[model samples]
Target: MNNNIKTILITGGAGFIGSNLCEHFLNKGFNVRVLDNFATGHRHNIAPFNNNHNFQLLEGDIRNLKNCHQAVEGVDYVLHQAALGSVPRSINDPITTNDVNVSGFLNMLVASRDAKVKRFVYAASSSTYGDSESLPKVEDVIGKPLSPYAITKYVNELYADIFSKTYGLETIGLRYFNVFGRKQDPTGAYAAVIPKFVIQLMKHESPVINGTGDYSRDFTYIDNVIQMNELAMTTSNQKALNTVYNTAVGDRTNLNELLNYLKEFLAEYDANIGNVEIIHGPNRAGDIPHSLASINKAKILLGYKPTHKIREGLREAVSWYWSNLK
Candidate 1:
């Protein structure tokens, strides 16, 4: 694809991951278009690109089919990232989550199909591996969903598969494993563990670890995710067109170890951060005991190579948060 002429539409482009994608593609000189309703995304995230000639922002919601259609107009590729995240949030209000994640995803898919876009790459979730006792999750192997959020993501994959077979629309689903990095929101009920812990430790507050801090996760970095998206969108391999890939670093870190890394990183800014106490609580509902991914498929198919491991990613994330959020 020609970097200067290709137009990529990123839905929810003001959100954490989406905004990073916008920045990356824009810097590469691709015509980057952003569609966001500011429901869960912030305007400040995209403020830096306001003056860029290659950047365009469309304030809209994916729940509306017209908005989706409008966003995809004249676009070459679609990076569908808009969704209501958080398993607990979905449990509390399944209807709203369904309306946005499931229905909104359908709208975007329909729009992309109508537009005849080159590829439709979307954000799937690791939560789809719910209730499965497997240690390392592979693409073809999955269990029943444990939460409404997981169900929505699984339905997205199902819908994308049907679209590919029935309408000949090329699509790829990326099952992300606990992605974290710069611009991740830390002040919300649905805040992810890494950013939340960083915020708490910065304030010298006791960071709570659910379930004895033994539960582990395959923490992926944002740069690695960007690489996966780029490869998914640009790959010419016929076998990789209509399947899912595990977008992860293929390693696990427990909450205890994660906290230790956070403290050590943050202590460079404030010595008191290393002295903060950690509290343990009961395990969260709809949360699995452990999660790891097999990235061999991605490596073989899309040439995916992770740039940062957990500790390295954590250090960079800490520096960003300290510089921006502190």
Candidate 2:
């Protein structure tokens, strides 16, 4: 990878995945700039990087074209991670979700295109699979969206495709499947299962499992996602550009298995976490029963070999929460 490509713009840089990307690229000596409105992102997530001379923060919203344009200026690459994330949140407020995920995504695309960014790498979602029952989801196969959030993400892919074809902009979409790891927020109504479960167990509270606990997901680690972004940004492969790839480990784990692992890891810090009873709840409206990714496309196209599997990543994440949030 050429270190000469100095500047990188990460949208939603104050958020979990985006903050991680900011740190990774900043450590690599790239001039990293962040555009975030702090709507769902936290100030503390980016506080440590404020002192870094190479880090610049554009406290703005992607919903505004001026903010997107300001963030993309002089940036070689754009990692679009800003969006209203949660299926249920979108269910309650589809309009807001569509505005940010769909409209804001278009704004970023137009800004990056006009700026002549070297590459635009954006976060796509596994929910786009929707009602498709196929196990181990492939990039091409998709069903009708089950929720407004899914529709918005699918629209993002569509816009990216049209932008690439019509405007000659290089873009790559990463359909992230339940990404979890360090800096992931475990609070609020829409928090992801892993982090939310970790927080519950840490507090010795009964972690509620949506559905029968048999439903599974390909819970990807944040590090794997970060690697995918870097590869997508820097890859010289002509075929790899302007296409979507599964950014996840090619594996699946059910809620039952997930809780067991969370207990095993968290019990290291507090043995009582093992006694935390798992509670059952109704299945979430937009959630699929099972989600597993076929990483063959990522491996062949971008040479992506995930460093951490579920257990390893969970252990690391547990340790972080215990040390920092406990």
Candidate 3:
């Protein structure tokens, strides 16, 4: 154990975002430890890091207090990314969603508090905006939760605030938008729109749009998310601690446009992909008509300058999926 190098404990470290964090920190010479139960995350995602001396994996669940505590031991910072995501999944099984996203989050807070970890940065959600009609969602102006998953993530913010105020634990929550990129699984039932669409288009299959194809999102890229997590963990400004920031690109693209972008990118690799038709499905329940983020707060507070917007991020994501999934 090198006393000089900081140790970061990233829960859900085998997932798309978490594994990326592991790679980033390890490359920067930080000791990275992961705690995951392999529920939703894949082993192949973190397999590359297994041989790195600075990387450690603790196969456990955040729902377990003992596991949380063990994970926090000797850790300087904690990035809590372990949560049951997807609004539809939460609607279908609210109980399991609450158990992991809320109960499990509480356990992590308690563990980090007791461990006296320097900072606790978590993966919050843009879904917390709920029914708010705000064009660019500011952090404070949110409406009622639209789904079970939104409630759980909102509860996480409340618990984190309480932990910060009551126990003096430093915490930061990043309300991530539609984040997608390399290593994001496209086969899952709750797969994110971008990766799913990319994979579908690559196979010359028609991608389905949930709504009338007008609903838009602030589709954030994985590298931007990784940057936010790093900033949240390392910022020295006292005012930056114990608050939530919207992790997004401050831009919105509708489902129809999103599909077109996928087609344009994928067609470059396989020209026939451009001819693939699109299928429109019924509007998904618990989905907001439009979602866009005001990243000004994150920019002002954490110095977050998104390196990739929709087209730039999507182009790279499509390339990665074509290479890896093909």
Off by over 4 Å in 2: 1-5
TM-score of each: 0.98, 0.98, 0.99
* Highest lDDT scorer: 1
Q: For model 2, how does the per-residue alpha-carbon lDDT over 106-224 read when each residue is reduced to its tens digit?
A: 99999999999988999999999999999789999999999999999999999999999999999999999999999999999889888899999998899989889999989899999
Q: Which ten residues in a row have the lowest lDDT in candidate 1?
A: 1-10
Return the TM-score for candidate 3, rounded to 2 decimals: 0.99
How well does model 3 score by local distance difference test?
0.93
lDDT for every model? Answer: 0.95, 0.93, 0.93
Q: Rank the candidates by TM-score, best first.
A: 3, 1, 2
Rate residue 308 of model 3 by lDDT. Answer: 98
lDDT of 1 at 126: 95
True-vs-predicted CA distance for residue 283, candidate 2, Å: 1.1
Which pairs of residues collide in candidate 2? none
What does candidate 1's lDDT look like per residue over 207-283, in tens digits?
98988999999999999999999999999999989999999999999999999999999999999999999999889
